[model samples]
Target: AIAEAIFRHLAPRATPLAGRHALVTAGPTHEPIDPVRYLANRSSGRQGYEIAGALAALGARVTLVSGPVDLPAPPGVALRRVETASQMLAACRDALPADIAVCAAAVADWRVAQEATRKIKKAQGAPPPVLALVPNPDILAELSTPGPDRPALVVGFAAETDSVAQHAAAKRARKGCDWIVANDVRPETGIMGGMENEVILITADGAEQWPRMDKRAVATHLAGRIAAFFTAQRSIA
Candidate 1:
């Protein structure tokens, strides 16, 4: 903590995000199907972790609510780890009353309606088990809802396989978030588990396509934009 403070103090740019709290959600939720197995995704939590670090560098008090991932917590950021979507939502609620929120986790859309306590054995001649699925909570929409606890700026991510910009724009409207970072995560793009990313930043104004760059670079750029957002708000106030 002391080292982080000193680094922030010596940083070249003024800490525009100082005195603000930022909440970030990262990684992929694991929906348990049985004691030995679970459903999950390919998210490595790199982008979100980088964003947390970048926000802390800008002097924001960051709380990273993460799902199961192998990455370590970012320096000077509080980390809350969870396994399932429900747990992730709870952690996010606990970190609320924040000034900024970035929902970068690729949460599972569904979970087994009834998770088996024991793994089902595959019978030699029987049909495979049919798993019933249920919708998981929409964390982004919940955070974006109009309320006192809602962050001033809420950013959501859209990992689309097709019609990236159009789908992301629709998601922004549907979720009522301030912005959406949309990216094509087609397997061929190597983005889901890769170090680099190319995203389209969708805002109420319009969509801005960013060049492919390292994930850390994307985080830094986004943090700069966030700082500018608060600066502009302060001026208007």
Candidate 2:
């Protein structure tokens, strides 16, 4: 069938990403305080999972450092499961020298200093429990900070609820990442866990906003851009 021929052609074209190594971080880490109490965020891991799948389809060797998430591993991709930002960082360091590193994980900004081995019992007329919080490493900043063995390209996400584009630009400058995908997570946008997104791609060149589209479309566009960048680099090389 003509459709079958089209599919075959498309499949081979996907091989552009082949022979390349990609590293992606996903999901929100849970920091346990007591046996029951924990600190976490609202990251659904949807975008990161989709990105991993896209990268795998492109024939890249993908190393996905995932936080707590329910998504299955992409075919032909190696996954490292981690529960904390520190663990995730360690995993990434172990992966090493990837062609591209995508920081999609919503890493916790802080963690409780000490975790209670046992759950604290509630007492009548007692004040609320106090938790001492400490800042976690800014993984993206660390990776993009002109380090040794850093990836050729580092992509970070800036999920801002206000001044999305501007903030993303600033974040890219501050973090020194090659690219930042900016999204407005205001409740009405329905971006979180939703299949759709309105995103702006921020880079040293400029900020380019894409019309609202499904996640698959966004992934395809991003993948294409990544491929183009690699191709340009190859030509230069």
Candidate 3:
């Protein structure tokens, strides 16, 4: 089934994404405190990678700005590996003017103020070491805000453990993005770093709920919907 799906996706199609450049960000950014330790999320980059693959299959010039992930790079896509949120933003800036920009990366909200040159060890009579943290740049917010080189469509991911749809809808408005894909990451569900997820698609117009499906299926459906949206826009124009 996997092989057949790959072949079908790679087959040529007349989708609107074809021939247009699409930029996708995936995985969890690691914020280093010491050489051997870092703060990161549970995102495994599965969904982001699948989205890139789906877009590529539709013939889009796909550029994936990925964070640290164990998964292999997607076939037939330009891969830019980044470890920090700042680096990811730089890559996105360089890949601008794309038709679509998907911010799928679970970025670290905060980072250590100063990275330790040497790993701190336990002292004979001391307490645990203290670490100062500062907020990381909001990469999605920066991209979605009106800019000279902003993409036509900006999509963000909101991983919410509670009030999933409401949080995602608010994020869409707060981040100034065209759409937000909201996922529930509660303990029992295990959506984060998991194979399957139930998602709510939130846009300015309204919200749509989709049944739980594998990450690959979600990506395929999103790609097709994007194509249809562009088609409608063209017709209206």
User: Poorest 10 consecutive residues of model 3 by lDDT?
Assistant: 7-16
Cα RMSD, each candidate: 1.4, 3.2, 3.3
Residue 176 displacement (Å), model 2: 1.1
Ranking by lDDT: 1, 3, 2
Model 2 over residues 115-153: C-alpha lDDT tens digits?
889998888999988899999888898888786778889
Whole-model lDDT per candidate = 0.95, 0.87, 0.88
Best-matching candidate per lDDT? 1
Worst 10 residues of 1 by lDDT: 4-13
TM-score of each: 0.96, 0.92, 0.92
On TM-score, the leading prediction is: 1
lDDT of 3 by residue, 178-202 (tens): 9999999987898776899789999
Give the alpha carbon lDDT tens digit for every residue of 87-189 in model 1. Answer: 9999999998999999999999999999999887989999988888999999999999999999999999999999999999999999999999999999999
Which regions of candidate 1 deviate over 4 angstroms?
1-13
lDDT-better candidate, 2 vs 3: 3
Clashing pairs in 1: none
